[model samples]
Target: MPTTALQDQLERGVAALGLALPAGAVQRLLDYRALLERWNAAYNLTAVRDPAEQVTRHLLDSLAILPYVQGDTLADLGTGPGLPGIPLAIAAPGRQVLLVDSNGKKVRFLREAIRALKLEGVQAVQSRVEDVPGQFDCITARAFASLADMLAWGGRLLAPRGVWLAMKGQAPDEELPGVPAGFAVRAVHALAVPGLAARRHLVVLGRDTA
Candidate 1:
């Protein structure tokens, strides 16, 4: 399929999800896809090559969690190639998003993507999740680690009453037992990525009241 078809599909997909993005958001997403493809050749940023598949797997797959996202500040931990972080940032221009990753090359790509995309209120930082400074109202991790380990490394970064959105292939039943103290699994949402056949789930975690 042509790039225009993919863009049209994306626009329809976002609309189907009942999310209203800004005027140029879809264009930015397409631009981001192109940048990812261009950089992937040299940096090995992602294994998926077909642009149409990327639209579904990479772009829409990340955008699936758009409705569940909350708050003004978000940190996408281990944001390799800026998956949901870049897409989410493009959708919500007013929100402050920080893409945190320890890999130098990935962070470099993220920086260049941010620059080329002209994504405002976004930054790419090179740091381990545990070492990242400050707090954010929302944090996202895409198969970066087990739910337990992800919180262990970055739980402190979640502000009081903040939420952690962990994207997974399926319900992480076993990892629930290993959740560290001071946190609770708020909810588990089964996400349906437009045009994606595989299962997708988002585990919501927040500070424990007890």
Candidate 2:
């Protein structure tokens, strides 16, 4: 597909999501996609190969949860190649984003992406989610792990009143029962990503205040 077509697809998808991004965000998004594509050929960072699919599955799919993302700091646990982290950072330049993954190659790609894209306020760390220190106002885990395990590992990183956004393929009804204690399911939002027909859901979890 042509570069223009990819840009058009991304633009349409962004519009469909009802998000008004900051100036130059669109171009940055495209640049990020291009970088991912280039690195993917040799590194196999992501299974999604086609550029068009990258726009739909990677970029737009990540932005679908933008409306619900809150707080000034976000930690993307197990962010392989910075799926939602990089895209979210590009979309919201002001927010501080931390991309965490244990894979050496992926972390290297993330650093390069951050430097190449000049994404200020974004940092990539190579550490297990459970070992990552500090708290974030918002946390995102995309198909990284089950609700039970994710919370069990990285639950401590969520700040008081912070929100955890777990991206899954379907409503995780079975997984709900396994959610660790001290965390409650705030809501489950069905995401409608443009140019893709797969069921996407965002499970919002928060620390139990009661």
Candidate 3:
């Protein structure tokens, strides 16, 4: 994806989305895309490449949940390449973002993207998913796991009233019979991530005994 053309399209898309980013923010995403492509040559960072998909799928797809979040702090689990976390931070600059991933290389790329984007209040930590103890105002993940498994593994890290935003491809069909008690599924909403194939949706879960 060429810089000029991508910039033009990004300008329109960002405006349409009613967001005003810094001068070079779109460039940073493009740079990140380039880096991903380069790293994929050896590191195999991500299988998604095409520029539009990078913006719509990788970037906006993660951002689709921005409207649903209502806090200043967030943590992303298994944030392979900073999916919703990075994009979330970009959309909400005041947020304190904690991105966690066990893979050192992926964390390195995340750190690089953070630096390139000049995104404040962002931290990329290299650690296992279950090891992050402190709670966050909100927690987000893409392709993490089934609702039950994710709650089983990462539920404790959520603030007493915090919400878990999981980006999924399919609408959660069957009720999670084994999903531990006290946690409730709040809402299921469809996410229209342009330039991607799979249907996207968001699952909002929190500590509710209903």
Candidate 4:
């Protein structure tokens, strides 16, 4: 599909999801998609090549969790080319987002996207999830690692009462047993990303108050 048509699809999909995105949010996401396509040609930022597929997989897939995401600060661990982080930041310009990835090339692409998008409260940091500093009220991990490893490496970075939104392709029941201490699965939400048929689930974990 042409870029304009793909963007039109995106606008409709966003509305279908009932997301009241701030002004220019959809356009910025479209801009980010264009940047990803351009950079992927040279830097190989992402495996998804088609712009229309990206609109469904990358843009809508990320936005599907917008309703669950809350708080003022968020961290996107292993955010290669800023999957959900960049889009989330674009949607909620008020929240601060840290896009953390160790790869140099991917981080470079993220930095370029951040600058080109002119996203205010978003930064791409090249650091391992375990080594990144500061605590966030909400943390997002998309196919980064298993539940245990993700929390083991970055659990300390989550605020005392923070929520961890882990995006998974399917129900990760096997990984549930290994959730580290001090955390528990609060909810498992099945995400319905527009135009994509694959099973998508968001595992919501919260600090165990007990």
TM-scores, each model vs. reference: 0.97, 0.99, 0.89, 0.98
Candidates ranked, most accurate by TM-score first: 2, 4, 1, 3
RMSD of each: 0.9, 0.6, 2.1, 0.8
Q: Which segments of model 3 are wrong by more than 4 Å? A: 15-24
Give per-residue CA lDDT, model 1, range 138-188, as digits (tens): 999998999889988899999998999999997888889899999999998
Candidate 1: lDDT of 173?
A: 88
**1 versus 3: better TM-score goes to:** 1
Error of 1 at 104 (Å): 1.0
**Candidate 2 lDDT, tens digit per residue, 95-132?**
88999999999999999999999999999999998799
Best candidate (score: lDDT):
2
Model 4 alpha-carbon drift over 4 Å, by segment: none
Runs of candidate 1 exceeding 4 Å displacement: none
What overall lDDT, based on C-alpha atoms, would model 1 receive against the true structure? 0.91
- Counting clashing residue pairs in each candidate, in order, gives 0, 0, 0, 0
| Best first by lDDT, ranked | 2, 4, 1, 3
Count: clashes, candidate 1: 0
* Each prediction's whole-model lDDT (CA): 0.91, 0.94, 0.79, 0.92
Model 4 whole-model lDDT (C-alpha atoms): 0.92
Per-residue lDDT tens digits of candidate 4, residues 105-141? 9998988888888988889999988799999999999
